[model samples]
Target: MRKTALFAALSVTGALLSGCGTAERLSRIGRAPDMAPIADPTRDPNYRPVSMPMPAPQDARNLSANSLWRPGSRTFLRDQRASAVGDIITILVSIRDQAELQNTSERSRENSESMGIPRILGLDSSYARFFPQGFDPSRMIEANSNNGSQGTGRIRRNEAVTMRVAGTVTQVLPNGNLVVTGRQQVRVNHEMRDMQLTGIIRPQDIASDNTVQHDRLAEARISYGGRGTVSDVQQPRYGQQILDAILPF
Candidate 1:
């Protein structure tokens, strides 16, 4: 019995040692993997991060229209007189006859009456002094002289009266001389003349919406030429009579 008990104890100890050796070998294998060096993320030149660009603010200097109208520049008025004359002629020639004039005159009178003003008020003609066309108020920068790169300049609107006389033509003579003598009631039309506003924009204040205002003029005129004869003497008087009949002022 003592021998059998001693043999069982030895057998149990050998089994435990064998199990421990297997477990240690597995642990050694796992530890071997940990001994390798970790990879450096920065060392990879090809692993570039995706990048995005930021949005830029709108630049006014890039607008071509805004750059044309510089403030306080008189270059815009170079041909203004000729333009105004052309516009007046166009309006006059378009009248066609006394019938159209009567219609236009009646309309003007009605408009004036509706506004609660005198019916026979003088029809005054004037030009835009410094009309700002396509002018964006938000883009208007105050004038500055110090900054060369800054768009700091003055912009002006200008207007003038080409002609201002009371009356309408009773007849456009066959010889191209208008007869103004008749006192018969007549009419006139208010029309828009083609006028251009020219200017420039400074470099810094370029984002302005610079545009011209159209059809702002309310009055126009007609001209006639005559040699030193009875026609010349009677021409102005006839014109005055026609104006009185139509305008009644």
Candidate 2:
């Protein structure tokens, strides 16, 4: 009874806390979702610097005497690829995945045991006359057992997504890799879509037009989601989510 009362109290407290958002939504019943303000990504409280193992720095490239062409330069003019912090680069995102798996397992066991005293210190001969009719000491005890079990499991999944977004070079690692971060938001009638991407890419991977493919980015983190009338209706209530998380069954 005490446990049940405590759980009920917690549920009520959670519902009350979640009601604050509900009240805000109610005030904007007929209005479209507000768009987020434009701000510097580096100023965000969640922003953090990226660090990794780097090899020792190498000496600068030596230039030839009176040569206009520089060694290791992709073009005679200044290279246009994004190599420094605060530069913009376009990212082309494309993903497609499909998987299927099935598993089965089976187990079985059987055992039998028996024990008897056919001739123990002549006692069986002495008690033979007094034993019950059709009784046999050779089969005094016996046991038999059998066990079996079987299980099967299966999984299937498919997903596909394609989009493009411009990202800013947030940092330049000691090894010449560039860290990039980008966010895109679109608001439609009573709905909003949000997308975010962050990763590191090598300078050589950038094309002449300043575009890089998603596959070239390492340690990538991508998110695509939204929140609005349709999204709210599709999600479970706060109380239901709390119960789903805490309930044993």
1-249, model 2: which lDDT tens digit per residue?
999999999878986879898888888898888887887888999999999899999987788898888765677867777888899999998988889999999999999999987888878866657875756778889999999999999999999878899999999999899999999888988899999999999998999889999999999999999989999899998878878998999
For every candidate, C-alpha RMSD to the true structure in Å: 48.5, 3.0
- C-alpha positional error of residue 107 in candidate 2 after TM-score superposition, expressed in Å: 2.6
lDDT of 1 by residue, 3-118 (tens): 99999986675566456744544564423212223333223454332222334545444435656655433456332211211111111122223221111111111111112222
For candidate 1, the 10 contiguous residues with the lowest summed lDDT are 81-90
Error of 2 at 239 (Å): 1.7
lDDT of 1 at 165: 22
Tell me the TM-score of each prediction against the true structure: 0.14, 0.87
Compute the lDDT of residue 35 as modeled in candidate 1. 24
**Runs in model 2 lying further than 4 Å from the true structure:** 1-12, 126-134
Number of clashes found in candidate 2: 0
Model 1 scores a TM of 0.14
Estimate candidate 1's alpha-carbon lDDT, on a 0 to 1 scale.
0.30
